[model samples]
Target: MTIDPEASPPRPPGRPRSREADEAILGAALDLLIERGMGATSIEQIARRAGVTRATVYRRFPNLTDLLVRAIEWEYQNTQPEALSWPDVPAMIRDWAGQLSVPRSRRLIRRLYGTVDDLPELLRAYDTAHGSHRGRAVRSTLEQARTTGQLPPHTDPETLQLILSGAALQHLAAYPDTTEPKDIEAYFLAVLRQVGFPAASPSPSRRSTQR
Candidate 1:
């Protein structure tokens, strides 16, 4: 499995954590978070759902908060594209559209957003695991685009990044049930153009490949 650079370091020296048990625990936590939300999720429930002893969970994570944080991080690590750098803007857009189109993914994201005040750690974990990294990758791609004239000379990648990210969040709120990949792709591409990214539309063949 690919390691997450932002993932917490290995546990202190002692007994090794079972990979199977870890997966089970994380998976259970995620399910409970989506099904029950943060307020109702507990370590005992996670342990029960994971089919592991409370002691087994305590041995791995100290509390419910830590376990849930790790669960969100694990989910992102599994779902996101592994490449830290994208070759181009359209590739990034394609990958993000596919990710956003999953119903479970949309639900999970909404659940995470609902945790902002009551359970800030989940969002923090997400930012650490993917948000910051994705921002850098997108900025780098925008820089390349500007140099290559795909974007206007005066286009500020940093400002544009913020705008693009905000637009995505706005879109998620505006159309919470949108699950069609092509529709999601079109929305993002339009947002990109509105923000001054002038990359041409994907050809029919490229669109088919993305599907």
Candidate 2:
């Protein structure tokens, strides 16, 4: 039998990629980012921690920024609030408090922000991946609040979002020790009230539990 000269060559059989190695690399990248920040963490460290070859990591994530950003996104998917839309400010605040209560989570957040100037690509990638949808959801929640009189009729959802976001970051800096969910919730509620948020009352369960 004569092989056609124009026919494509047969592909060589190669080893299939390991899910475990992929997970290990991602987890190592996230942990390094949280512990050492971008400046201090290196691909070599990640590879050593992940027990994978540097070539393997490069094959999976050709870009360092992409690797770190993907690792952060993975962490958020696993640890952050799950709801795409919140019904009220209190619910959103509670979820935020719950996630921020974890010291590791707070450290990760700080590291991400710290890398803004050094590794802006990471932030840009993250915004591209998750910020747009979450931002729209937040604005919609604020609009619902305005409609329900939780906010003033003239309240600008966009501005309020910026203020609340700044408040949370400031709170993190000012009261790093305040890791308890109830305490964080109280602090956020106070900030909201000060900003004329007038959020709807939390559920009876939360009220009783807080007390």
Candidate 3:
């Protein structure tokens, strides 16, 4: 398991906060982080964009690093697998392809990955927070499939998860002609075909469940 930096330095307990303000601040922070990155994003900028007082932003987060960490997490959550339970392998592949095919998602992925070397803390913050949610879920689903004899005896869940996600991320980051959802969907299906995507057993647990 990876260290969870986001869980450390826990949030302080206080009076109930205004939900709208929280959303506004987070929204503004995410926009700034994506548009300019950690170096350029600041509390003042977020405050101005969110139309909230600096004090309000401070009340929520003590520092810019914390704020950026949370904003990165917000972006990460938006892209994670939506299925809380098991999802169909083919369908999830297509869904991920569709997501990565979009211009917004492409830019977000490029920005995040482009910053990985320069800003290790950005990744540390995100990885510690929610980077592995999709991997975990996919692993669980693969394990279930293997255990049920739906997948080949040689099927490796971890590697499969890496290959699936890695391909999607690479395609999103590297490909320019994949802006169409169908293009992405087609690409993922090709990957699946190469891997011989196992047919799901006629079982309830194998059915896709979208969140």
Candidate 4:
């Protein structure tokens, strides 16, 4: 799953927020989170890695949890393409599976899921901060897919989204150590079959040629 970079609204009418500092802090936090698990990554470490004062981080985010959540979401804004299009969906799916199979993404995702143990409340707060960015995009994509007959007329995007996301988490968790590409692709096909994906399912090579 991805977080929205624009999760935080404009700093109220009071003081100006430093955009440069915001970017630096979030970048540092994300790097640290990937390298170190949530339990080990600290606010002070983030501050030090970011080359900013602890006060700077606190000013941008209330605490370590907020800092971590925002950093995850911020990557969505900065790293993602301007648009998530249908033409890119197949490739995006492949890339997502690849990411899930990798070390960094696996660690970050597991860490987020594990937050329930000690920071369930903080995770809930992050859900509120998530806003409508990714949800809206997913909805729009499903609607377009439906319109194009890429999904069955009777398909429910919301339910499908939840199932796919949940299954993806399960997939990552099941292969906590390593996930083979073949395994991920098999999982991908299973998910598509369940969703009744209307397109002709192609082998990776065939898909590349088709694209």
lDDT of 4 by residue, 1-211 (tens): 6543344444567787888889899989888877886778898898899888777788778988877777766755444433443353455467557667777767766776677788775455445444244455666677677777777788787887777678788887776547776678678768877777765556899979998
Q: Residue-wise lDDT of candidate 3 within 45-147, one digit each (tens)?
A: 9999998877778878999877877777766665535553455565565656666766665666666776787776677767765656756877887777767
**What value does the lDDT take at residue 36 in candidate 2?**
88
Checking candidate 3 for backbone clashes, the offending pairs are none
RMSD of each: 10.3, 9.3, 10.8, 10.4
- Write model 1 residue lDDT over 1-211, tens digit each, in one string: 8653324354578857689999999999999998889889889899899988777788788999999999888877754455767777888888778878877777787888899999888988988988888888899998998888788888899998888888777767788665688888898889888866785567999999999
Top model number, TM-score? 2
Write down the TM-score of every candidate: 0.79, 0.80, 0.71, 0.62
Better of 2 and 3 by TM-score: 2
What pairs collide in candidate 4?
Answer: none
Q: Which candidate model has the greater TM-score, 1 or 4?
A: 1
- lDDT computed for candidate 4: 0.70
Q: Let me know the TM-score candidate 3 reaches against the reference structure.
A: 0.71
lDDT tens per residue, model 2, 70-126: 886776564244575788988988878887788886787677778888888777666
